[model samples]
Target: MTDRAALQHRLEQGIATLGLQLPAGAVPRLLDYLDLLVRWNAAYNLTAVRDPAEMVTRHLLDSLAILPYVTGSTLADLGTGPGLPGIVLAIAAPGRAITLVDSNGKKVRFLREAIRSLKLEGVQAVQSRVEDVQGQFDCITARAFATLADMLGWGGHLLAPGGCWLAMKGRRPDDELEALPPGFALASMHSLAVPGLEGERHLAVIRHAGAAAAPAAC
Candidate 1:
């Protein structure tokens, strides 16, 4: 099979394993986005994972693994290099408004192209630091961006009242959870299982102490 075909097959299997019900044509669009990333990465060095098959597993699947926990109509992905969950989530949930924030000019340029080429509505790529990003979102996502305390310290203001912060980590970070900055509380810690991926993956769900309570499971 050709590389795209093989990647499509693997993506289908992975989405099935995750039990996600995506809209029609979503998978194909996602594959096309991956193709763009691969093409851009050749010069920009976007991601370390060069292989498209591995990108399906490590980037696409890994990002979509958090779909179950994503709620609300607006989301901001801080430090969204190459738009991991940001771009992927925008494709999966086109109705929601997604903002991909990154300080890197090259990555932001790539993100803008992806948004334009994909014809993705309600999605914008902002070239700015996490702290400088304005507007509160109902949900915020950060993938290995920084420690829980640090992420909150920088982008905490961007989360709307009652909004939730979903931080993706490689392993359970008990220490970071313990050191959570004041005014924020740990809502939950979920162990994520990305299909075909080895090693530990965890999602730290956090919320403001004064914010309204979150629904169960997020």
Candidate 2:
């Protein structure tokens, strides 16, 4: 059985560490999502991380680490397995139209159930390869999805003008940065310090090369 009290305490602490201002009732809803993930993971193997306690930091806190950098009115999380930051973001931030995209049928099934169970009004789950997904978004996020070049190559067209693509990676991908498909440029890169997470994590912010340059994110 999962330790609900311990997980809640830990999640609360992690949110505090991230300095996030989540909407009311967001915490309980996050735990609900986590529970759903845990139950579904038991049979489907949706995520590699198995332990519910470990998931508090690895899955939940790790995703919340990027909350500060998320901007714009609409967001899409490509390759969102079991809703990672997508469901987490929809719960915490609220109001933004969020789409969780993944090519795997089982994963997308989990996402649709998550949205329905969580009562996430504006969130959606799309089953498609990133390249085939339609419509532009003000913000795009791809976590552990693909190399910078490949992600941009497949989904770069979905980034609306003046929008940003937040690519989550481990080490700074210097080589991949150079290979970004012709029009995208690195606006900023922020090193993320996720509570209780080991190793380095980086979020690369990219925009159209023609857009006015913005200062590096801290």
Candidate 3:
């Protein structure tokens, strides 16, 4: 099989392992997105994950692992370098308004092209630092972007009332969670298992301190 075809097989297996029900045509488009990233990374150095097969496990599957936790109509992916979970989420579950934010011009440029090429409606790419970007969103996602305090401190204002913030991390961020600025509280925490990924993965669900409480995830 060709390299891309092999990558497709790996992704299929990973999704199956995750027991996800993706919208139709998502898998193909995801592969197409991977193809785009491979081409662009040659020049822009988008991601350190240089291998396509590994990206299927590390990037695609890792992003999809958070799909179950992502809720709401509008989402802002802060510091979304080359649209990690942002683009991946947009492709997997259609119809959500997704804003892919990045300070790097090259990354945002690639994101715009991906949004256009993939025909992803309601998805926009913004080239700006997290602190300067404006607009509230129902769901916020940051993948290994920064410490919880820094991320919440910079982009916390963008989180709408009753909305949730999803922080993807390598392991349980005990120290960072404790250091979360006032007005933000942990809603729930989930351990994520990505097929073929060796290291630990965790998702921190946080909500505004004043928001109404809800039942925690099972």
Which model scores highest in TM-score? 1
- Candidate 2 deviant stretches above 4 angstroms: 213-218
Candidate 2's TM-score: 0.96
For candidate 1, the per-residue lDDT at 97 reads 93
- In order, the Cα lDDT scores of the candidates are 0.94, 0.90, 0.93
TM-scores of all candidate predictions against the true structure: 0.98, 0.96, 0.97
* Tens digits of per-residue lDDT for model 2, 66-131: 888888889999989899789998998899999999999999999998898889989999999999
lDDT of 2: 0.90
Better of 1 and 3 by TM-score: 1
Better of 2 and 3 by lDDT: 3
Clashing pairs in 3: none
TM-score of 1: 0.98
Give the per-residue lDDT digits (tens) of candidate 1, residues 16-114: 999999999999999999999999999999999999999999999999999999999999999999998899999987899999999999999999999
Cα displacement (Å) at residue 86, model 3: 0.4
- Superposed by TM-score, candidate 2 places the C-alpha of residue 192 at a distance from the truth, in angstroms, of 0.6
Worst ten in a row by lDDT for model 1? 209-218
